[model samples]
Target: MKFFTAVAFLTASVSAFTTMTPNKVASSNAMAFSQFSQQSALMAAKQVPHGGVLVNQMTDDKDAAIAKATVEIQASERQLCDVELIMNGGFSPLTGFMDEAAYNSVVENMALEDGTIFGLPVVYDTDDESLQPGTTILLKQGDLPIATVELTDKYVPNKVLECKQCYGTSELEHPGTLMVATERGKYYMGGKVTGLNTPVRDFPCKTPAEVREELPDDKDVVAFQCRNPVHRAHYELFTRALDDPLIGEGGIVLVHPTCGPTQADDIPGTTRYKTYEVLKEETANPRVVWEYLPYSMHMAGPREAIQHMIIRKNFGCTHFIIGRDMAGSKSSITGEDYYGAYDAQDIAKANAEKLGVTPVPSLNLVFTEEEGYTTADEAKEKGLSIQKLSGTKFRKMLRGGEDIPEWFAFKSVVKVLRENI
Candidate 1:
């Protein structure tokens, strides 16, 4: 019987992923999801099943999630402990994995990063800022665990793909494609209207409970929500915010990158994730906190800037970094008319209670050989002429494969854009 069963299993190309067919093999041993994000998977699995065949990417009955990836261990930390091989899909710990001898063989043969053992569930979406949801991490000799992969759809019993993405605002047509979302996101308003609606998250999606517990017992937590990567301009804004008396308490700077959609020619998500990873790995600021914000981008430009401020406020961000053209867009005609270039300041000033936070607005900055984060005043005083690059110019330079000097961007960040963008 055992031989016959083995033969059947080998002959049949049983999918290692989802069970889409009507083959009912009642096996009691099913892989489990983490306690934190398990219920969401269960609910989604009911609709799509594991490794279920994708009939169509457009309307497939699958759990649609936005994900981000960040290498957690410190780079300088002890020559790295035994690294785990992560699998893609869920955060399951792979147990009884190959022996150390076998592991050494694999490591010796391939680059440590290119190791073939997929102990974690990883998806390569360069679009995710800080490795938000929709990814799974695995531990060697344990079950593979999918991280906080969030859903952009509403999950109804039986039909997971039955939901609508939020239209940025009324009077604006909704450009939605049908989708099934997971935890760490919302379908409607993308948490803009409801304010990071708790219902949007599939798991607890809290601050890792332990992180919250381990947080310094400060009298106040002044969080800085970053929708973009850590650019020099961003650093300057953060420094300014950190220096502010109203927001200087505990001097907490939380870098929360958007976990959803961004415009074309924008820095890919993985690069953003790597940017934060390096920052966390290298920055001298112990007060900086990093969290993944799972809100999708609308590319609505000025309205997006306002929305960012409001949403950050909802997420307990005491203040937000409102950079020039927070989410700028170009008008259809003459390539003119940017959306809400001043929308950040205007919204925060006029609708503080409605938005629920303070907006630290900063103008577009250019690096000067002399002055670091200079404005028109500093430019004149320091005798440093500021040569700012427009979004169009930057994109063109990238496409033309031109080198971005330190005067324009950090070499490391520029390398990320050149490769990922």
Candidate 2:
């Protein structure tokens, strides 16, 4: 049978096999239908959001929400990112900023009040202690109103406790801990949000529903989360993830990069987005789908992996690729890594089954003179000559106008970075 015809046959036979008794259906056809049914059920399970419901807080009447606002507050870049995700169902199971109960629960147990796993608390922070509950506030980007919140509760957050619990450390050296301690406001506000407009951004972030619509219903969708420009190794890693046994055949990888506020020193979102656009045009891979996510990075390592998985699950991804030291950061003073290399992979793997999303550990790939982009084990066994380039060296090369090896980075991506940086 032709490939398309075989698919049609399996789909058509599934229903018939379900209704037929034992020995009534042909054994070979029955086996094919059984496999097809399992795949269908798996895909169906992935479609369900983390909390079994996808939350949509976007308001149809923007004028009404604007008029109801008694106070206006300019949102920070991070807050804007959070608002976009919350409004678009990227932060499903979350209708708005977390209340005190929810915040405390997530900080203490990494879960919501209802025992639903939530990696971190999403709360609105402000220094204005005079703001009271039952008041309406409009959150804006500059003069443009983006979302409105009906304040239900306001409380001082335990910054140290939150940093320790969510990020595994309360040290000022840790970026996430530092952010919570110095950057966040004194008061944490909670309310249901009504989105008025999405912030103006260089890259348009698609809603979870929109992304889900583009994904294949019968094939597994593997999510690759990144905050930087895609390099050649990064390309090989995600593309190879499609061939993983967990993904099986006909699976596709979603190159979903966060085009929102990341580390202060990282590439600008606009520049990074441009690099992706150029690389996508250059490669034109059919098995890959590129999309942008408006999420602010926390550098919380293991905990952040859970957060990414939940968000991708809402976007209809069945699996997530967990790389070494995923979302990890370093100490500004000692320059020591905050989390272990395998910490994220371990935590993500531990929670994968419960989240309904499988965690695919990224291969430790290395570049060799004899064979390009082979697993570290294979290179070591063959005693191949390995090529290595550090990030510090790469940046220097970009500054010096040195030609970068195509094995280390893509030519198109290098061109964009060189021009932008």
* Number of the top-ranking candidate, with TM-score as the measure: 2
Q: Over all chains combined, what TM-score does candidate 1 have?
A: 0.48
Candidate 2 lands at a TM-score of: 0.89
Q: Model 2: runs farther than 4 Å from truth? A: 1-46
Task: Give one digit per residue, the lDDT tens place, for model 1 in 47-142.
Answer: 221222111111121123112222321211000111111111111221112222222222233111223222111111111233322223211112
How accurate locally, in lDDT, is each candidate?
0.37, 0.81
Tell me the deviation in Å of residue 193 in model 2: 0.4
lDDT of 2 by residue, 1-421 (tens): 1343223322221111021111111012222122112233334534567766665677788998899999999999999999888887788777678777778788898887667788988888887867887789999999899999887777766776787789998787887877776677766777777888989998988888777777878788899999999999999999999889999689999999998877778999999999999999999999999999999999999999999999999899989999999999999899999999999999988887778889999999999999999999999999999999999999999999999999999999999998999
**Would you list the clashing residue pairs of candidate 2?**
none
| lDDT value, residue 303 of candidate 2 | 93
Each model's TM-score?
Answer: 0.48, 0.89
CA RMSD of all predictions: 18.5, 15.3
